[model samples]
Target: MQTSNDIRTPAEIYDELFVPALFQQWAAVVLDAAKINPSSKVLDVACGTGVLALAAAGRVGTGGKVSALDASPEMLGVARRKSVRIEWHEGVAESLPFEDNTFDAVVSQFGIMFFRDRIAALKEMMRVLRRGGSLAVAVCDSLDHSPGYSTFAKLLERLFGTPVADAFRAPFVLGNPETLLSLCNDAGIENAQVRQHSGQVRFASIASLVSTERACAWTLGGMLDDQQFEELSREAELALQPFAGENGDIAFEMPALIITAHRP
Candidate 1:
């Protein structure tokens, strides 16, 4: 249960690994649930690198505004560079800076799971959203469903024991729909619809995957120390030996979830 602030440098964490593929898959799903309109003022909470915010900007167009907020200044910086129109704010999800009922819709992707006070963050999201406004959030389904990472996890557990595996489990808190739905209810969001999605996780090589993990030190990178890190990296490379192809590319499928809710 690490707070976003506990991870001091998100820019370093996200430089290599990003939500690009995941975002592309879920953005449409989120937008569909959000029911975006040209006149809708959107708030993207914990908007990392502005994937949803940028997509929201496209949906809102010139008539509306997109206010993207994240605790990580580095993330906000990257998001800012992509689109000047998006009003990027350095803030946390637990306490939003905007006025009450400021947004026509509020959306988050893989963000709510990281909140230290989940209820407070959701309440804030609900508070800022206008009555009848929509809330769409996407979270990782479960570790079992994510084979690319699941296999890696099993291997890591075999090597490092359960403690390390438990640390990795935090990011997949909402993997279960029942738990996620209960959390939504706790936050006062009703009538939530959970949708299932899957995407391909591609790596140019085993080395590429390891590099990406090092670059994005959020979860995978954070768990390992210098010795453990090198050991795991070498193990991963060895594990991928069977999958290595003529071009040395390896790809796998990872499961994802798109959980959407609305204010009653």
Candidate 2:
């Protein structure tokens, strides 16, 4: 169950496993939702490993600028190695370091759920947007909506306990569309549009899926020890087998609620 990966930090695990499995594809979706274009100044808040920021940089080309911020120096360190074109800042979502009207577009992919004050963060994102600019945010859809994770949650509950399952369910906290809309309204975001977009999750194998989740602090980290992870991996082989393809790859629908708003 344990391997050389056990020594790696959560951010390293996230950048190596979770980003490719879950986040990389969504980066393009977020940038597209924000309508990123050449010459646009962009900021990616809570940018883990600079996936979205790096994509925005390529989309904007040399004519534009991309800056990314996250609270974790560990995560920023991983992101910094990926590209020098982006301005990586270590900061919290609730208080951005940039000045007002600084960016043509601002985005956060799967980071809103952990913010201490969601409304404050939203306001800060809006405050940094130029007029006619856009803000696009993505949060996981409810666990119920994601069939793979729904079953995984049940599996965790049966095997580990409700507390362990609940930790896995934390990312889906803001999955409700109405609740997300209400939060945007409370933040005074104008003309916000919330839409559900289906995304794909892939892992080399069921054990790969379970092990990566074990390493992710955003999910099962600290909740599982070596024995627990080994047990979960054994069970996941059978529990998550339905998602396995002929080649033994695991794939599932991991949808997200994308909220987009344009400043008038």
Best by TM-score, which number?
2
Clash count per candidate: 2, 0
Quote the lDDT for 106 in model 1: 91
Residue 154, model 2: Cα distance from true site in angstroms: 0.5
- What does candidate 2's lDDT look like per residue over 96-200, in tens digits? 999999999999999999999999999999999999999999999998887888889999999989999999999999999899999999999859999999998
lDDT string, candidate 1, 1-264, tens digits? 543424546563353344643455677678878888999999999898887898889988999999999998878877787888999999999999999888889998888878889888988988998888888888877888766667777777887888776666656778888887788789887777777777666667877666555445455656666678678778988776665567987677666676676666
lDDT of each: 0.77, 0.92
lDDT, candidate 2, residue 51? 87
50, model 2: CA deviation in Å? 0.7
TM-score of 2: 0.98
